[model samples]
Target: MTYGHAHAEHYDLVFRSRGKDWPAESARIAALVRDRAPAAATLLDVGCGTGAHLVTFAKTFAAVAGVEPAEAMREIAADRIGAGQVHPGDMRAFDLGRTFDAVTCLGFAIAYMPDTAALDAAVARMAAHLSPGGVLVVEPWWGPEEFIDGYVGGHLVREDGLVISRVTHSVRRDGATHMRIHFVVADADGIRTFHEDETNTLFTDAQYRAAFERAGLAVTRVHDRDAHPGYLVGVKG
Candidate 1:
């Protein structure tokens, strides 16, 4: 709940530093939603950092809205999808007084919630915002069994004389993976180090199903793609 400006900006710099291969990933996620959603008119993009998914959803859906908590992240998302479309609120408590045909929390955003109680609370919030026969797609965090500790690496991207590098390390703890990212951006302004810490709960597929059920959403089935091992498509019933 404490991630703020610097953390959010560093997050954007870390994942999107490459600015390549994301289109394919975004396209794939959009296609999956189109296939599984009851209708793709209204979508609630929870934790829609920088509007990556919101932009994609807007291209297909008639109405698209995003809920982003971080101010820095919201600014980026607003620039992509327009300021009016993005709501500034926490994923656990944001309410729009309406329902959507589809709700998606991609990029393991749901895992940021500290515990099962927090996860359940957030899911209940999402469930309330979803219309009858709507669909909810969640890309959960990698389970503890899948985490690889002590992984240290960095990637650099160069575009138009601007360079960005993101270095990351991971530590696995009680059913969670805590990651620290170091971002270095080189431009005419020089180089700087921006640090951020993120924690994701490693909830199992069975636990995910149970949480959805407890939230009053019927878990139709889970579609797993080997390319994205931690992704799950749950059609609400």
Candidate 2:
């Protein structure tokens, strides 16, 4: 399947399957960004899945907007945050013809870009939407080396007494990581199965820094938190 269609379908399943963890995680990431950003009046959230981070930031910032490529995800986000706030567009090509004090792309959204060229293009696109001295926060995917072979992680969700179990596995090879996720949901309607497959390049720290510099942004700091893999913040000169 094409990336767009696959992403849209995957996003629907993910949100339905993992809605519980989103709010707290998004809030924490927002706090981190707010600490580094100026008293900004506005913020833009790229890949703002389900408006989790975007809505949270809107509560504190003067204005908050989001760009999400998946229509299903955008619909869910708009329902929570209002229709005017979220736009359906790709992270690499969205243009609002305006700038913001802070730009954020969390949840390892950068990994979705395919290659260094696409990653660079996305960073440059984001940079163009940042005001002078603004901050661009990027959360990249973990390198393939970090994945443990033959290991698995899974979660069980019980909402309104309906249970769903989602299991994930990571397989690494050829300088890439392939993640396969399986979901089994049990409801009044009976059992249902959903499967998703995603791939991310095993990019190194140096490669990320190079991309940031090439986009004319200076890497100010790299933070590694125990809770999350962490992020790199770049400042527009």
Candidate 3:
């Protein structure tokens, strides 16, 4: 994963680069958890890149932990919260030897699983780490039929005497998003460019539910009137 070293340095700056209201969006996500698991006091964010979700979750939950596969991202997350609060492990298989009241797999992280079997493993692992009645919230990538092929996007950011620009070209193929992302960073040290290639699997709503059910969760797929991609909500039984 390119995020392990290079991209991790720029990961925290991305949402800001894209003009996303971090506080607002995190708050909305927190609200969603409160709605589904009103009594949830602990949370674990799988693929907790840069600890963005955990930062907000900390405000609402009594205890918070994050499982991030990328060492660099996990390191920053440790700095954000505490070293002991973050774990270095893959979402497909991780064990903290404890259960959480709520588990969050956001940022379409599940899309990186590559296939349905991998999704099953990840979902089952997450569900196994949930207390009875605990809730799992997953934000997934677009389904095969829903993806818009040849999609292009870009972002620019200026921070701490550095300027960064990123451009991405993506296309849907064979139930995956084949994406090429290029980044240019300029600072006092001069300028440099790097690229990362990613293939995020496009799993449909039914497929998502199937994984949750196989994990012994009661699942429901929800859609809103807004443009925001919806989520799958599952409750451990």
lDDT of each: 0.77, 0.76, 0.86
Q: Estimate each model's TM-score.
A: 0.88, 0.86, 0.94
The lDDT ranking, best first, is: 3, 1, 2
Instruction: State in Å the error of residue 220, model 3.
Output: 1.7
lDDT of 2: 0.76
Tens digits of per-residue lDDT for model 1, 1-237: 346675565555556664534466666666666776635678888998878777767877889999988788889889998899899988778899999988888877899988888888888889888887777877787777778887787798776767778788988887788888877778898887777787888887777777788888866444456345545665667
User: Where's the lowest-lDDT run of ten residues in candidate 3?
Assistant: 221-230
Q: What does candidate 2's lDDT look like per residue over 26-113, in tens digits?
A: 5665666567664767889998877777766877788888998877778778887888888988777889989999898887888877
Q: Which residue pairs of candidate 2 clash? A: none
Local accuracy of candidate 3 as per-residue lDDT tens digits, 114-195: 8899999999999999999998988888888878899999888888998999999998878899999999989999999999
What residue pairs are clashing in model 3?
none
What is candidate 2's TM-score against the reference? 0.86
Using TM-score as the measure, which candidate wins?
3
lDDT of candidate 1? 0.77
- For candidate 3, what is the TM-score? 0.94
